[model samples]
Target chain A: MTLTAKSITKNYKTRRRQVSVIYDGDITAKSGELTVISGRSGSGKTTLLSILGGLTKPSGGSVFYDENDIYSMSDDKLSRYRNAEIGFVPQGQGALSALTVFENLILPASLSGSKAKDRAEKLLERLGLSQLRDAYPRELSGGELRRLSVARALINSPSVIFADEPTNDLDDENSELVLQLLKEQAQGGAAVVIVSHEQAALKYADVTYRMDSGRLQREEK
Target chain B: MNINTLMLKNLIKRPLRTGVLVLTAALMTAAMFGGQAAAKSMRNGLDSLEQRLGADIIALPEEAQAKTDLENILLQGTPGYFYMNKQVADRIAAIDGVEKLSAQYFLVSANAECCTTKVQIIGFDEESDFTVKPWLKNTYSGRLGDNEILIGSELSTKVGSTLSLYGVECKTVGKLEETGTGLDTAVYATNETVQGLIKASQEKGIAVLSKHDPEEVISSVYIKVKDGFDINDVLSEINQTIDGVQAVRTKSMITGTADKLTVFSKGIGIVTIAACIISAVIMTAVFSALAGGRRREFAVLRTVGFSRKRLSSLVLSESFTVCLAGALLGLFLAGVAVFPFGRVIEKSTGLPYLSPDIGAAAGYAAFAAVAVILTGALSSAWAAYRLSHADTGSILREGD
Candidate 1:
């Protein structure tokens, strides 16, 4: 398993109330595989992905990458792991609104300590975003916005990619285009985790895991 | 994104907000710089006066109050006197520790027919004196002569015509350079000419001058100590030996009205500095408000995997850029304001001109800019640091 979660849990402490978002859970995604985490809204799908990507901490269990507990490392090390090892694509609009399309894609690559101008240009060309390179996030359509987010994530060239709702706001044609890109990454020997509640996403995922209250139960293969 | 590029992008994102913020920073910066510049002007003026009055000890009337009044012809007050016998100067010069000496011969020429305006006449031995000689940058008038009178440069503008000396008319011989003192507004003549005028004025019942040739007396002698001689010992000896003459040492002079002037100059500077500090606090508040309004943008940056450290660098970059612009602008404006006003201030008042120092204008400018930058940096850094600890999920949901 390239990325693994072993019984992770998280609780939100607030002035008004204490909310348990994610219960104990274990899920794994290996290189050259596609794992789809399917759940209803508020089923802790996004919460599980945040812990695996080292963005948010789990209250109980620890996440491991190639058998080393990711939580044991220092903040700087985890940040590097998130930057260079695991690529993250949040909501389609999580692409920075203030930055231009080219700037958004270049951010992840720059943080990873690579200044490859040629590669960024090629990525924009590959995603058909060359014409919209100077456009800001607010100017992008739903379909163009999703392509830009994917560009931002893939620009760092990480071994694993975690995408939350890659097809949430896309039309059917644009959704198929996004799913095809994910399938290509898995075929190219990268572990790809897609967090979605839509049943349409499962048709393309090689392995499907149903997240019920943060527990992963294999539903299809 | 790289630190510099990210900071540039963030500032350009909201041009209007950034422009207004920059203006606020510049105003505070100007106050800090301009106040310090005023203090520097005062320091420079005081130093100039100190250099001119290089006497080790000054001898005057027994009552210090009388001496002060006599000195008032330079605006001390009309002029009063308790005369020392003409022989007294020689007697003091012959003292054991006294090296060399000179005395003043003061004469008044108020409401004279030479010009519509009134003027004061102060006669010092031009041969052995250091007062006006050091400041004579350029002499466009007569050189120092025995019985010839020299006019102040500005005096010529009023009374360039000839004047009658004791019922004998003579041309205004020469003019002295601008010395930033009452001398600039007075006519300079020989000690003999002044005494001759004093004699005639007393006979005419214009002033209380001596009936005889005034005993050839000089008012207030300045004594310099021979090297390796204790100045305090000489002061004590003169006090004990001379019955009606008083000796004022260097230290006593710094505590006199001259010292009060120095204290007042510093007080002005302090009030100006306090005002600058208040403006800097206001600047900090302005920057904090800016960072707070941009919280959602910062959260989006966090999602893109920018670390808290990188976020801090971005804020500081903004601060440095704004400070640099504000400092340069403030310095340029202050230079424009101070140079002309300094002369006007000197001309309006009989008191000396004020200046903190030469390099201090720019130094104060930099100091103010750095203070503003550091304050903005601290507030922005703290706000962004807090942004990192925020719940990413909540921020995203709110944006949705």
Candidate 2:
């Protein structure tokens, strides 16, 4: 089933006052589609994605997938959904510094109780990361690290892959490689969500939306 | 494969820091276990001595006691307990309801080097000695021949297995079964043997030794009341009837002995508890620092769809693994540490000269280790929870 965020609202608290971040929004990404969310800094792209992924509680409204209000489920169920069904390539600090490249890439499968050895090796070879399998995150080039992050997000073979700026620090070659990989995941019947400000990523989106002023604006797809 | 194993590996990635923590915990455990062993042995020895002495009513000259007679004996050979003339034994025995009395002139022989231990010597006459004989019914099993004596089992095991008391060789043929009485480490002898030592000391010009005619000399006297007689009444009657005599009953000595042991045990207990506290604080501090240092990694786990609960499990599991390792290692090192000390204890205090009690040492270490592990786990758990809740926006930028 496709995921939809309908009028999801959120607030950020400071000592002075609580400020509304995501006022209200209706955004949907169907199966086998690449949905790109681009916005300027502080426009709440991450907050919007967090609500869609059930990573944080929204101040108001609800998120739905196949007509089920995800906010109504228990915290544990939400966590299991995140672990077994959704893949997230988090922004900064994506790599577990202590783990090797292979271990970091396979962490999601490990956490979800899935055997990931073959998948991990396959991903490493596919991403041109086989040579650096044993290297720590600190030893990798920026582009290599970003590719590892994408590999980690795909380890569990989730129905939905949410990547936040999967190619933020990569060169044109690595950037193109990462975008093509996400498009391939969408083409393979997985819903792909990309949160990035990188204009180079727009060419690969099946459907794209703009997050402006903490609101998702529909654009021609 | 589980979150626990993954977390443990991450926590122990810095092997040097983890090793240091485990070693500290082991040392703390050993100190705790060792100190407890020492005090336990001491108390066991004292209790045996109490049962062995067997004086129901102890008549000491009252005015000069600084501490209880038992404490005085434990510390300084009971000399602070004033020595009244032996005449009080007969007079107290003359009181109504007093069935028997015996006198024993005991000396804390500092200069007398007997085999391995220079200990207290009590001089008792053969007749009217109900106190020593009753305890001897069970403990004093060896034949009392010239230079033939029964050294305490603890003492017997030491110093060639036979004692040289007052320059006379006495074979310790048997050890008292576990009486748990205070006299477990004492040496017993006849009035003649002790008198001869006194005479020999006098010949050496130790004139400060309390003057007592070899015929009637004794340190303190023991009294037994007739059947159906009130012990308190006999005690007061002895006080009223006998001059220069203070008659104390069994209750006094029991309380006195228990109190002395409590004081010593508490001292050792304080030290053990302090070690536990220090270890816990150190473990917590080290773990907290480790957790803080790994905040980025934990945040990364959160982003990978590992829940806060999973993160917490990983952190606590790491702490548990360390505590278990430390406890087991501590036990091994403790066994090694106590080997020589155990022999000394078995020889001097006679608890038993066997292997260290694993159950006992583990029991003590468990008390401290569990608490410390929990403390460490709590710190790590808190840090992981906070990291999970931290704003992922900044970390995402950093990850990028």
Candidate 3:
């Protein structure tokens, strides 16, 4: 499935004034490709990613998954769609602190009412997190926690993966590992969208875009 | 993981907070359960007292009324010996509205060779008695013989044991049901045996009665008024027509005890209300703080496809588990307070409180459990609503 966002806008009502975060943002991510969005802090890159992933509603636009408008579905249907079709990897410290590494990895599949033990074991082995299965988030280092979060996002084998700064708190070695995993997910015929400002992430992107003042500009690679 | 497992993990991670929540719930339930049990027991005690009295009015010699407290003699088992003219019963029986009348003879045995213990000996006329004989009908086929006696339930000796009263060994024939009153320490016999005891006491140099005339003396007369007759009018008539005698309505006799119970019940009610209010407020505050602290966790769950309703269910399940555990703990604590320590409560409160019936106690426990759970639910519902309605993007951004 191809994920498309058209003329999306987001506005926030602060106590002092109304702030517009995004304006007329357009982006697309197709299966078998890694789409990377780079921007400075507070440049609406995270906001755009949130709208495309159906985690937040756009004030004045629509997101479409293939032929279906995502926002038009009922809340319950949208939730199920997210559960079965989309995966999200948020920024730093995303793993639930109360759950162990293994429990956190299987959370998405658990929510979808599917068995995930085999898939979780495979992901843990692949991410080198097999030894930390019973370790809580507090016991994990920054890099291990990031890998656990990514493993959770991939547990359902979702059609589209939206990862927002997944390597924000990781060292150089762990960052490279997480980026390679995202690239592999895209190679396996899943749409992967990564939102970050890291220059190193650009090397692995099949298509890259830059955000400035809520506007998207394609950068020739 | 299932919702229950997730909820349990969330609680177990914060052991101190979970313990506080459980303790609060327990306190609320224990206060409610214990107060209700105590109040019910007191009510049952009052009912038992009313049933045992069975008489509308009691007429006794005016001098006897002054010498003996009627409540003490009949309610607390304090033995007393008093006598007035036996002709008073005939006079009260002739009074208008007097349906039935029975005269009883009272004698107290001293601590001597003639007595098994210091006990009250009540003599009933077999032909004219209505109070003691009806209770004995279920055990004995005919009237009590001269040597046979009926003992109170609290008496140390069982049936078939011979009780020596005033130098006369009377065979125990039956035991009366417990009334939780002074009557439990008394002994009942035929008037012939009572007369024999009186003669024996005088011959043994133990003059129990101040009067020497046994044939013409009576202690107290119990009267039952006919239906539709005003009891106050009967009381007034008996007091005015009978000389050297005073009449008391049995209902008026329990006013003091009933008032004490009412005050105690009201005190418990006030305490329960205060505890409910305090627990509700504390639980609300705690849930609100918990929701606020876990904003990012909820947002993450929502992003992973948990609907707002499902999120709310997670919170409710956590609250339900805590409250249910607290309720069970509270019930156990209440059982400890009521069953094994009932006498201590009675002595401290200065109220006659019997142990509540098991069925009634179980019902109260169920009520308390439900009430505690509902309290927890109500306290957590607003927090859950606010959290579920929060924007997922904002909550996720909160971690930044």
For each prediction, how big is the interface RMSD? 2.4, 2.4, 1.2
lDDT per residue for candidate 2 within A72-177, as digits (tens), equals 9876677777777788877754687767898888888877778999989998998889999999888998778889989988888888888888887788888898
DockQ of each: 0.28, 0.40, 0.64
Best by TM-score: 3
Candidate 1 local Cα displacement, residue B165, angstroms? 15
lDDT rank order: 3, 2, 1
Worst 10 residues of 1 chain A by lDDT: A89-98
Query: How many Å off is the CA of B252 in candidate 1?
Result: 9.3
The fraction of reference interface contacts (C-alpha pairs within 8 A across chains A and B) present in each candidate is 0.28, 0.46, 0.58
* Per-candidate local distance difference test: 0.69, 0.69, 0.85
lDDT of 2 by residue, B1-400 (tens): 4544675666467688879777766766666666666666555555554555565677777664622654445323323223566677767767888777788766555444663445666656666666554554344444465544444444545422566544555555444443333344556667777666666667756633555665565677777778899999989887777767677886576575567657766876897788777877788678778766776676667667666666677777777777767766876676566655654654453232233256765676576566556655664566666666665444554433
Best model per lDDT: 3
- Stronger candidate by TM-score (2 vs 3): 3
Q: Can you write out model 3's per-residue Cα lDDT over A12-91, one digit (the tens) per residue?
A: 99999999999888888999999999999889988888888888899998999999899999888998999999889987
Alpha-carbon shift of residue A136 in model 3 (angstroms): 2.4
Which residue pairs overlap in candidate 3's backbone? B75-B182, B77-B182
Could you give candidate 1's per-residue lDDT for residues A72-178 as a string of tens digits? 98766766777777777775466666688988888877766688578789878877889998999888888788888777777777788888888877888878877
RMSD of each: 6.3, 5.3, 3.4
